[model samples]
Target: MTDLARDGTHPGAPPPGVTMSAPDVDTHCPYCALQCGMTLRATPQRVEVRSRQFPTNRGGLCQKGWTAAELLDHPDRLTTPLVRDPHTAQLRPATWDEALDRVARTITGLQTAYGPDSIAVFGGGGLTNEKAYALGKFARVTLRTRNIDYNGRFCMSSAAAAGNRAFGIDRGLPFPLADLAGADTLLLVGANVAETMPPLVRYLVEQKARGGNLIVIDPRVTATARQATLHLQPMPGTDLAVANALLHIAVTEGWVDKDYVETRTAGFDAVRRSVAGYWPAQVERLSGVPVADLETAARALGTAGTAIILTARGAEQHAKGVDTVTAFINLALALGLPGRPGSGYGCLTGQGNGQGGREHGQKADQLPGYRRIDDPAARAHVAGVWGVHPDDLPGPGLSAYELLDSIGSPTGPRALLVFGSNPVVSAPRAGRIQRRLGDLDLLVVADFVLSETAAMADVVLPTAQWAEEDGTMTNLEGRVLRRRALRPPPAGVRTDLSVIAELARRLVGDGMAGNGTTGGRTTGSATDGSGTTGGGAGSSFPEDPRLVFDELRRASAGGIADYAGVTWDRIDAEDGVFWPCPAEDRPGTPRLFAETFPTPDGRARFLPVEHRPAAEEVCPEYPLYLTTGRVLAQYQSGAQTRRIGPLRTAAPNAFLELHPDLASRLGVADGDEVTVHSRRGEMRAPARLSDTIRADTVFAPFHWGGAARANSLTNDALDPTSKMPEFKVCAVRVERA
Candidate 1:
């Protein structure tokens, strides 16, 4: 193995070398959703990234993005495919042929014994657009399975439910990040952007410079809250109460957008009546915010000429996540924030290409282009494009939580395939999910690292990382951009698409494609049923992304988005172009609802939401509220970044964040090992005492694994509507080790 030497770059170091050898090779930092544009300087032995001028971030990259290059060729990376002995739990390196054959046989056997519904596939938001799209299609058309979902269910399902109910669509933000700087007021409901997306948070600083009023609402004094003009530390699970009061004030004070509501909305009367009982006084009791503070926030949001509301996982990780998000939108509508300049509800996406992954049909209930699979018309449209019979398509299936539970049981799925996601670490009730995976008849996983999830797989296929793959991604604001591959994969690794193509052929026969070698290794039976002839003997399967995208374009015919003008040829000429560009004759819709909405009556709907209790309540046995979140140095689950030298050096291990006052009462001090136990599990980690959080609440970074895995202690109960797990509010007890 070759050991790559570092070029003296730290996680937070600035870019170096102004000029690059290849100009078109200019790319963006491959971390976080911020996606700071950068130019690459390639020397004979090393590569350096230099910040480039771009609209989103003014030549700035966070620690994770700046040090991404160091992770390109880590020594611990999985370089070959391995097939594990099911009975002995022993892994052996095998040719691609042997691995694919074993996987195909197991899937077929599982289908024959338990039916096609007994096979499932799990996807991730971090995968490139092309890879995510292909995985969804393969699960349905080739494998004929209804159980397909992604980690987004754990991350953004609440925000999606809110958008679909409020505005009849689910794009993150109507306006771009730059527009935030032009607003008169910006309300950050549940996000800590300064610590998460620091470069993008520059817009908020600029807005403050313009005399814009910034309001931050959270249970803690987060980094972003310290910079806000007003900070309201509401009690836990009480955001809905505060939001309803704001709406009550808007309606009573005649601040509601009467014309917009009367012209383009539904269910206003129900919402108005529901919020009537939530006056400032009553809400002040429900939430920790004072009556005066609630009134001040309402006035700032209502009287301001332009304002917007931004939410994050903090608001959507609760048991009532969907209801809380809807309340937020209702507050925005009462203040006339949507369908206008510099004002709307924006969800800061957690994954780099989460917006794109959802749009491309990787979600459980959705098809390509945000089309619902349950809708016959949408099914027909997509089926026609894929050249399959509508009757062949599967119906809506279980979400991630249900899917995980379904593994191994007779009535549950027996075969499971994973791509780019580590469920063993990210999924709630991690111990249960791990046991279920081990009990499966077959489990196949493709990743760059031997993640905790992959460690239990029956088959493990090494795949190329982001820097070794060429594709595209969609940003939080629905902007599409290119992902350029700057180097080649390690010795025996291959692209994800290649493995999927081979597996699809083995299961469904020649109908899938040819050779099954998509820029990867080739061995053994090419007879895994890949060819040009099947139902239609002479028809050829389109394997190249350029060809598949054309069919996708045709699938979106006549909808709000048209792919007629968006050809691979066109996209190749530049970085990339946003969709709904429609044609060469039209410009892309930068902001939605500028004139009208896509709702049935051309009006948004007001969802009457009520506050609900957390999944579990604090008791004598579990007396603390445990909240999970991320740090700037690591991504979710930390499969790749945590393995890198720079990232590991910054924050070496997980620590429990507790209030100093609470620690004092408990006889605990800084750096003292403590045991945190929940209803399902317990973990011991060093403590960090701080006043940033409430005395009754504790915080943990959800990126560590092993005995310290945070999700193991998280509650698995899901929101009835969105099927999102209760990751934020879990009851636990802490004591000295």
Candidate 2:
């Protein structure tokens, strides 16, 4: 955290006419994985934010970062807790005490009536690392329920799975973002960073100015694609085929780095055989991309001195997403990109803390430090840190979408607690998810604003905003950055860490018997009792994020994404620190895989993958493909961005983006209402005719709710490996509404 001045003055000086009572707090943006650095200063009337020098943004601020301060005091901010009156069955404002009591009582009653697994906890990727760690501990230590997971499962699971499969690790970006500026060739598959992260465009601009080849593969000529030297528009869900074709071309053209492949990688022969069948012409016929374009893209990547390949949500939200990403990794390996100084394959994580959020225990199958829940050694190490027996911890749970789908099932959780996420607006098959939430015996949601999910909660707890709390967030580059609070939270608003701690203490004190002990050792090393407690809960659940983080460092000491060497003071002093820092005296690793991979054999693996059709393919009944993504003005689900005046004004509602030819064929003009139908459900939005999109594909922003909810038309087919739902590609039909 940034230090505050004792005297009444700003960091350097107060603005010309404004007098400050304290120093401005230097912090990172509350949205996106870039985590742009900024300084928050207080004036007499309003708070102001200015860009700060940072590794990712380089002192550049996107529109979202410039206008983020407006959301601090939003009119719709939830100031106090709300509890549903059982008789009236309507939400009514209640004191924090009453709300907490009701929540604990309900959780206890539900567990006693059903089973310990009847209660579940749902977390979010936007949560700080400390909060995420604490919530995961609360579920395992207090509730002893295996039904815990977070929203990041929807964002980065497929990429993480593929990265781990091929490299024995997944850190989002193995290299820093600044490396993009120096690349000789950069290939972006299904990533539209231009709109989602405008500040990052400067690096692309730098690469272009240097005469580097910039290639983009997508179904639409998006803002980012328009900037590329070559754009290969493939049909949705065919990214794997495109990657395999590029590899096939590289092999046919004799562009493979045979020496590097022989020394630094394994299983290349299998991958080479797999790509042998994906001939350029055959792939051109399978996907919509042409043969010439495929050959051109392959040559650029193959011949470049330093090349990078990246995948994003567009390529990783299908039932075949893991295979698609693995295909890309196979190509990168064949090109000898991994473990190079400045070139590699990477994933563009979407949420603010998606990389860090998954590193901690909030993930369904993971423990802190990215440890597998089913691993005995990992369970023993984490349990020792929590002062519990390894046998006391529960096993793995369902993935995000599967957990939501099982909400009303006979064997699934009957009660749920949500923190920092509004799943109703974000989950695939959202309409059915909404009905599932309604079917839950208890639904508790925590947020600063009344989001679509919180609006229907049986209990709503107000949480502190980003600038009103102090914690840490790990950016896409695996750099740990501090989030400093400029001011205290509102009188009734609390932090999620505090809420989880208090709830765990309450459950422990009341002896939710079927579970393990919680209260005594909630904080790291608060008690000396090493093994599992017999029957009583401790009262030592700490609410301080710093204490929780201290515990996290110890829990993650020897694990994969180790944070033992990182400290708050070090982060502030060094700007930010990268992890797997095992000791405080050693500098953290900024660039990974320079010498060797982390696998047992010390070599990157080449996983042979084959392309498959999307789970829901377009047929005669639904003859068009539907895809969803973010808009420039709205962040994911628009839980916070929707409430900001400027952001909402820029993108007020969802729109149906289709090719001009498709609009003309449907007899619909721009601004005319159109209905999109799929096997799951339908959504209505205004037509946004443009020649940028392919004639066979339609696009929609997934940031809106109500009749314009795009996720309603998405498929819920899960990827067998990653458990990621098919949110990007689905079969649909369009009509004038």
Candidate 3:
């Protein structure tokens, strides 16, 4: 197949540049994982975005991507450092010198009093690969602390955990998105790509045009589901049963790929027995999907020449998320989908860099290149690149929620450094997390905007925005593309790398020598005995993106997501490059496990999983299941997207979406005020009545904070294997306000 056909870029003629003289800089959008390619024409006044043909989103731009430039000149953008007054409890402008010195002193004092682990670092998946790497390195080497994790643990941790257990690696999408176009059938579970990533719906449209069938399993008839050939609306948190029942039908009808299963997989007997109990009738009773529809969906998958199974947060943000994904995988294995062209299972990553964030040491239990932190060999390899002894490196620390939960505890970290995430509006039980932030001795937030989380920080550092920075971001398809700086950042703002380096110098002294060595001590020769670069006690960390990427390459040499062969120059020349490119001249592996699986015996494992009830079940008191998701106009947390005038106008605030029956029962109208109360907290929003959702379920977007924060009612119950909170399903009572 041609590259254009295989990569899923433009299927027609390319468009001309908006400005031919200046040659607009080609870059990807700063929104979802599709990272839709776009060209920016920069002028003294503003930047204009135009679609650029690329693999993921082709030449289309979503509403968020089209309005992303508004954030560059947002009125509330943080242009200088701010330090909160101890007595007044109000943040006031402060000089960089004053803010840095005070933050350093507070962190040092905290470490001295409560030990190294007392200082924690929290990062975000929106950060570039280089920033994520630098943040992890700064946490482990400079602070010498084990308390470090990123927001990705809340995004797709369950999918990652399940993928690793089943495939020996997790790269979001093993095959290119283009492969979906050739599949005979597609079974999408809990993903509303038509609304979340609008450009991707073209593939589904194409599939339908070609007479291919589409099966969508979700609690709500989402926009994406409206286009499906068969939409199976299951009860919330019953996805595992739907998947198990499908496999049961396939096995009972003698539609299994017996030869492929025996030759390419192991542990099938256990899975077969596990799924035998989930017959169509039983699944229909538990999942609320009719037996006729379940049979039709199963037959479509079982008989298709090639099919694809894709899932997203809806099926993964539950107490049994790993098992839910595992059940889906078991169905794919039974049908011999994986390792086949135009077929296999993949997770649709939500965040822009969610696929790369966890692969590069930002996760609590991981190192760069998807290596486990507890593995001795992995530690030695990463430590050697960082110029530190393996023994000096800290072991696995707390996961994202665990770290957040420990913020104000007696034995918790006394200080926290947050970069790029607004957890105040995004975290499960957000109201509690906000209160926890209030109790911290020191909270430092580095972001371009004064987000809800930054507003509560003791010190807020102004950082460079996406268009003003040069780095690389890995999209959902495992393709790493370069993001070039089109213009200079605001005068007072600094890049995240610069902020991280400055903090490292102040906290660890001469260890700022970008070589990654700490020298096992914290002392320097500058003011307050802390060294400055250029003329002080030690060398400075390289602020250049290329230099930092060189170190990242070295650190990831032998790991699963190896990028040693990929470089900025190569990315610029080739549009993008896929990972596991271990050698300079070697072509990247586009579709993995074509010949053999990555497991020990070169065979895929069929994990046995069973359906489980939601962690927080609906009862008489709170007799409705509440699920949370995103809206088309707003992105995560609404930190940046809300600042855009048109987007804000499009989606002003959060609302409760319920079936007409439920709305009638509650005596609420479309625009009537309603109060939703859960065990943890209550939130109020306008009720939006619809028949697309199950009568026993309600829906809300989790993008807004304050009284509209959906996460305030989300459960923090952890998935045993993934540690992912149950953000998709919770119990709540709705009343007219």
Candidate 4:
């Protein structure tokens, strides 16, 4: 490794023999959506992390952020490409040229045999904004396939869907996290912020100190629930009923803000009629929450001068996730919270770049700046930016789960390009998804380590890690921040941007051309690639992050998440800039919809919703309800965090958290091995008995793969609107193993 300054200046750039101390680079943590600011000092052996004052984390770093530097030089980090041999059926180290050529040839052959859609690309929520934008453009311009989607679909699609429908825009948070300090009440629905993002817990403490109330709703008595002034322990999958009952209580108690509702919102009459049947008693019977607690929670929210509702995966990872989120939005709207100064509705995004990943064109049905793919105007605007014909771009494709389920089928994709995600362990029904990957004719993966998903790939391309890359990430507040390169990548390793650009150049050389017209025109010779592709000769993907962001600004000019005004220099000069900053002179809008909503009528819409049972109901044979979540020591799938010695030792393996009564009934003591059997499969793990959880519900962290994978028992029932899988609740049977 070579010494470099925080401004990305190399020591060699100075006069010869001039000794320069390695300057600490100001960068953000590579963990969650919080994107906590940190300074990194690069030494010969390792990198050191120190907290930097930022609005999101405020000079704080979680355990994961503090230990993130260890991942850069982990013993198991991949340094070279690996290609599987057809004869030996084993992965062998290979040069970059050989590995990339093999991948390109395999994809081309599959396209020739099955069609362009036969090759699909799957992205991850943790990818930087530049990488996500490039991946989407690659899929449309190079592969010319409508089969591109990302892991964000499984994380926050439900919340995004509801927010788009209600507010005419989808941002995880319309206001900054600091606003929580001024709120009169904070209602957290199924979100364990204390354990998920520890720094955020301070806001709740500040609210309490200011004589405000805090409400937590979860099935278990999580760490966050312990600090709440009122905790409503509702049964899993019944959050809709609880929300409706709260609205019903507000209406009956005359707590609704008549002036705000009448002037700033619409469809309240229908929502009021819909919740008329969900009284306190009925809600208690359905959601297992006491009537007294429900009334108390409702009263606190209704009486507050300004209140905010925050939700997480626990509330949105269900078959009726969209409806559940919509119900929460309805309650916020009735109280006139959306555009209020100190109140609104927001979702806590889980992944590192989850907010930015979905804003670009990585999702199936969206273009850059969160534009709809099916809209002609949006297509024209983006196509012009890419120097391609509008008709050359493929229409909306299958979503994340649907694309995975289509593998190996007659009309499914035969080849897949996976970047930044480990679907083998993260996707629902892990056993089935593993088989689908095995059935693919060609599988290519670009990752820093040989993750569970990468181990199954035919060609694994080693890529640069976060500390070795320069990019941008949008935090939960829709604030775009910079990620500076702290050190050079290891020899033989490449950034994802470089790899994608090189591969696109090779594919374009094979005769694929961009559509030459300005209008819709389907080219011929799909196999020969002689016809015009969307971004044929005109497409030139720059490997530099700054250049990619410049093109991104043009593509996102007029869309909902406009970022034309955001520049790398501006991000580095300030803490961060919020999106919808469409002009260079604008300072960026930190808070949106202050006086009016984005709808045509400038009013928020309230949708009526009803409660539904879990996708997989408990039966006589499988009497226990199974729920999955994360632990503090590990991140999603533990692909990178698990490699660190300290973090791995802290959380050695997964375990089942069951109630004392349930464990005793099953004849299992603490640390006893138990077999959790579900309809799809079964997993064995040690059981730890605790009284924090409900007697009928058992919890397991979903950060491990193989024998301890929690997704093996998760249900894949999709929400009709958001297409989110039911990962929170399922039926299972527990027995002493």
Q: Root-mean-square deviation of each candidate, in angstroms? A: 5.6, 5.1, 5.1, 6.4
| Better by TM-score, candidate 4 or 2 | 2
TM-score of 1: 0.92
Model 3 over residues 298-404: C-alpha lDDT tens digits?
99999999999999999999989999998998899899998899999999999999988888888899889888999999987776566566676789999999999
Count the clashes in each prediction.
Answer: 1, 2, 0, 4
lDDT of 1 by residue, 1-737 (tens): 00101233322346353233454466666766666776665566556566666667777766667667766667778888899875777988898888888887777666766677777899998887777777777766766678899988888898988888788888787677788998888888878876677677678778999999999998878778888899988766678788898889888888888877776677888999999989899888777789998888888888888988888888888778889999989888766678888788888887887787777667888777778888998876666555466666688889988998888777888888899799999999888888888888788999888898888888999998777767777777777766777777778888887787677666656322211211111112122122321221112134455555655556555554444456555655644566666676665567888777778877888889977668798999898889888776778899887997767876788889999999998899999998889988887789989898988899888899987788889999888899989888889999999
Name the runs in model 3 displaced over 4 angstroms: 1-23, 510-540
- State in Å the error of residue 141, model 1: 0.8
lDDT of 3 at 631: 80
Please tell me which predicted candidate would have the highest lDDT against the true structure. Answer: 2
Residue pairs that clash (backbone atoms under 3 angstroms), model 3: none
How do the predictions measure up, each by TM-score? Answer: 0.92, 0.95, 0.94, 0.94
Indicate the residue-level lDDT of 373 in model 1.
Answer: 85
Q: Give the Å shift of residue 40 in candidate 4.
A: 0.3
Clash pairs detected, candidate 4? 513-533, 514-533, 514-536, 515-533
Q: Which ranges in model 1 have alpha carbons more than 4 Å from their true place?
A: 1-24, 86-88, 510-543, 559-564, 568-575
